[model samples]
Target: MHKSFSLQMGDKTLELGPKPLVMGILNATPDSFSDGGDHNHVADAVAQATRMVEAGADIIDVGGESTRPGANEVGAQVELDRVMPVLDALQEAKIGKPVSIDTYKAVVGHQAIQAGATIINDVWGFQRDPELADVAAHYNTPSILMHWDPNRDTSKDIVSEMKRYFNKSVQIAEDAGLIKGQILLDPGFGFGKNYEENFTLLNRIDEICALGYPVLVGFSRKSSLGKLLGVEPKERVAATGATTLLAYTKGAHIFRVHDVRENYDALQVAHATIYGPPPAKDI
Candidate 1:
């Protein structure tokens, strides 16, 4: 229903909806579930981001906070310290790809946009702080509005509830003077829901995609995948690839993942299957 859309960052315009785009994850947090603490420094962050770009990432998502379930929240200043230097380094390095800052704090979001982040991947889905919406609007940064039910310690009709949550958040974002082109929707697969809830949402992804915005599906090494496949975090690569392929089939325009190459390959196969072979090019 989005009628085919794309996001413009710098001189590049990334096509979305008609096919899936890979959003490689680069976590600078010391405790991220995957590759955490490994890229905490600015140099390492730049290297990791560069590697992802080489692996065919359409967008690089950089996060300083570990949003793993039950992770203790860090202060805004700490988050800023963790992310800004890497952001500065990435810009200085002339990274060609658009960078997306993964944060839920308004101050961090504001500074990240100033630091050259063109996208805001808010895990809280604009529910954590009222100021976040204002920050996003102030910068006019393209934001990924994920489905997060702020109903703590409750798990009732999660899929339906999340749909409602996304609708309200979308409305609020629109009211904040954010253009439709600047908004993308994410289902927040493991944010506040149980395993069953996650699958139900996954099976019905089109319901969310029908909201008339680009859909971002992120389930990389998530506990829900582990629970379903009975595997550990390190063993979720194959499952992650499968999920990315499924999401592509279900109209997902973007995939946030740790293994960029695997998802990139999986997307190629999915695209070929869905739309026949690519046109022949002059070598």
Candidate 2:
């Protein structure tokens, strides 16, 4: 069985377990690999977030910078300018879900938490800016650390390398005062892995979950899916749902995705099939 966690995010308590949780991806940047410029405006982003929540998203992850391979990196000020408004607007709109800031910069993470983001999702797994861990620790928020190292030799066992990378990330978090419950691990689906290595990582993801932290997988609309299905990012919802089911069976605790309702429906069916139907509600 997958491990469960109860994370305290400001006034809210996020429960991750039993059934998988869906974290809707809200990329406020204009250059994300998918959905770029889709929610660049504050009103559009808020509207999309509300739709995701209504569609059963458990969390909303707001990212200002594009971390896609070969995408130009934006500075901290630029990222803050792009993201702060959305964070503020989401809080003001009261989306009723913990908002996660997707960034690898310490400064941006710091200000984002102050701007009302309750979770810190570092794509670089604190390797890019170790100080980001400190920010999460200081705010006492849950942090999702994803394994990413483009320079690593992919010829080696990718799972082993990922574990080693996560070991360092966990140490950084712990050293920065973050406890086990405040941490989540991601396999970094397409970030640093080659085509085969990506599949190998997904196949061996249970090993990462075996490390004792809730595993969050974000294979939604990734290029890997595109390459496999010979489709564009916008057409990969079904493919993304397929990975969601596979990862769910493999003990993954959270799924970060672009398409919320499809994945939510997929998880509901899968959970019901494995664990029996959920308790019915009164009319």
Candidate 3:
């Protein structure tokens, strides 16, 4: 069984537990691998966030820059321009869900927190910019440190290397004053891993869960799924839901996904089967 964690984000608390939490992806970039240009404007982004929350998302993850392979890296100011307005609008809308800023840049992460983001999701695993951990620690925000190494040697044992990378990231967070509860680890399913390596990581993800931090997995519309199923990005919702069920059984605690309702439904069924149905609520 997976462990539960209470992530304190300002006045909001996310109870990530045995019935994994869903983090809806809200990319405000024009060139993300999937769902780009769909919500670049402030109003559109807010609407999508609202929809995700209503669809049962426990958190909304907002990203300004696309991290797809070979995507051009934008300057800090450009990224800030794209993200700050959306953050402001979401905060004003009172979305009633925690917002996580998906950024590896320290400047963007810092300002995003000040603008009302409660979580720092660093795709670079606090290894890109040293100050990003400091920013997360400064605000005492829950940080998702994702494993990403473009130069990772594929011949070596991938899970072992990932464990080492996570150890380093955990040390960095601790050095920056982040406690164990404020940190979460993501295996970065698609990033830096070849098709075979992605599957291997998933197969052995229980080893990662044994590290004792909540594991967040993101396999939504990934090219790996397309390669496996010969479908386009938008058509891979079923494939994504398959991974959600598999990963949840492997002890993952959070799922970062684009199709919130579909993934949420999949999790509900899995949870009911494994843990029994939750106590019914009153009308």
TM-score of each: 0.93, 0.97, 0.97
Name the TM-score of candidate 3. 0.97
> Candidate 1's residue-wise lDDT over 1-283, tens digit each?
2248867654567667566688989888998876779899999989988998999898889898998877778999989999999999999998788899998888999899989998999887887775778888887778998877656435456656776787788777778877778889899988777888778888888877777788899999999988888988878999999888777787888999998999998888888777776986699
Q: Decide which is better by lDDT, 2 or 3.
A: 3
Any runs in candidate 2 off by more than 4 Å, and if so which? 280-283
Pairs with steric clashes in candidate 1: none
**Model 3 alpha-carbon drift over 4 Å, by segment:** 279-283
What's model 1's lDDT at 226?
88
Error of 3 at 51 (Å): 0.7
- Number of the candidate with higher lDDT, 1 or 3: 3
Higher-scoring candidate on TM-score, 1 or 3: 3
TM-score of 2: 0.97
Sort every candidate by lDDT, greatest first: 3, 2, 1
Instruction: Give each model's whole-structure lDDT.
Output: 0.84, 0.91, 0.93
- Model 1 misplaced stretches (Cα beyond 4 Å): 1-3, 10-12, 150-156, 279-283
